[model samples]
Target: MKRTLFAAIAMAAIAATSNAVLADTPSHRDAVAFVDQAKIGQNLPVIALSIAKQTVTFTTIASKLGNAGAVKAVSDEINALLPLYQPKWNENIAQAYEKSFTEEELSSLASEGRSSKYASKVLAQQGVIGKQMESTSKPILTDLVTQALRTVMSKTP
Candidate 1:
């Protein structure tokens, strides 16, 4: 009885957390717009295909694992998984774009991205912006990781 009650409570907690996460997720349409503004779709297909190709190798050991005379197992598995992976890749890209940009930024970006001059200017400054972030964040992240590792190590011995 106690175990069953605990399991029910745990499930309720997980469901509540899931609902909260879903509620916080940005609009999918806004995410799609953000992806378009960022030109993420232009290279998404090529990147997804490349990643899928590599992923095929990971699950191709069915023959070696003795899965009952599996000659075309690898090929069959790859074919089956490709369709599943493509949509996930697109969804992940959309989610990333949504999480990274606010609705106002996405709206402005959609309009500005259509302008060649604006895009060119933004593209030119992109590298500088990345460098600025790297400079500002590297030290902070390094310190955080170092401290975390030291804590773990100290706790161990």
Candidate 2:
């Protein structure tokens, strides 16, 4: 219960700040640019997954772990933070840039905790349940991003 309360407040504060940062009349590309500026590493795939219109929905896992409130709160927080990550969408573009990657680049970006510093910062307070939620969410985020990208980037759907 205490964790839930703390997580909720923390997420709410983050949401508020992210929105405040963007409140100065931002553009879509401004958001996209944010995502695009990220360096390739552990964060690339996660950013790719995110830009493909994918998401992390840990609500069920949260509930099972007695943190449903925290889950919802965090989910909402991500929605709010989406704009901030908009520019780092290269991972999504990497499909086209496959030729640019050697085997090592691909391997490097996908390793466990590849983006440990950033990932840790983002996941700083996540408990066992939250980590479980992240592990479980990857596939779902991948599928959703693939579908959305197909629809948006292709001439014929």
Candidate 3:
């Protein structure tokens, strides 16, 4: 009991310190959670953002923007699929991010350059958009798998 309490305190302190450095980058929070869950399982945490190297044809419309705008762009893309999957997404968040993000109460304004299946549909096109989707999906898929692994760990007997 003592050891578990100490470990929890340590995790909370480390998380608070880490969040200070990442106070502005909301996307980085997901990556950090991926890394944390990886650490708990003694796995490597260097998947890297696969989307960082890909090129895209779309221009962000924000007049004066920075990294925050870039984060907003990604959020917008995710929001576009909500109408088609928002019900499922709500359930997923209720199960997944229930204590963290207020997804059900908040409507997003971010719009993407394309849809969720953009990569599969345009794989042969060689358009910047196709590459863009591939780039984005890889790390997102990696994190998704990592979260699944975390769930498995949580249920271990």
Q: How high is the lDDT of residue 35 in model 2?
A: 25
lDDT of 3: 0.29
Q: Rate the local accuracy (lDDT) of all candidates.
A: 0.37, 0.34, 0.29
Residue 59, model 1: Cα distance from true site in angstroms: 14
Name the candidate, 2 or 3, with the larger lDDT value. 2
Candidate 1 global lDDT: 0.37
Report how far residue 3 has shifted in candidate 2, in Å: 16
Per-model TM values vs. the true structure: 0.35, 0.23, 0.21
What tens-digit string does per-residue lDDT give for candidate 3 at 25-73?
4443443333233232111111111222122311222223444553354
Q: How close is candidate 1 to the true structure, as a TM-score?
A: 0.35
Clashing pairs in 3: 76-110, 76-111
lDDT of 2 by residue, 1-157 (tens): 4454333223222222232223232232232232234332223233433343223323333434345443344444444444544222232222212222233443333342335333333334334323332333344344434443443333221
lDDT of 1 by residue, 36-104 (tens): 556543332232223333433223432244333222333344344445443433344444434445565
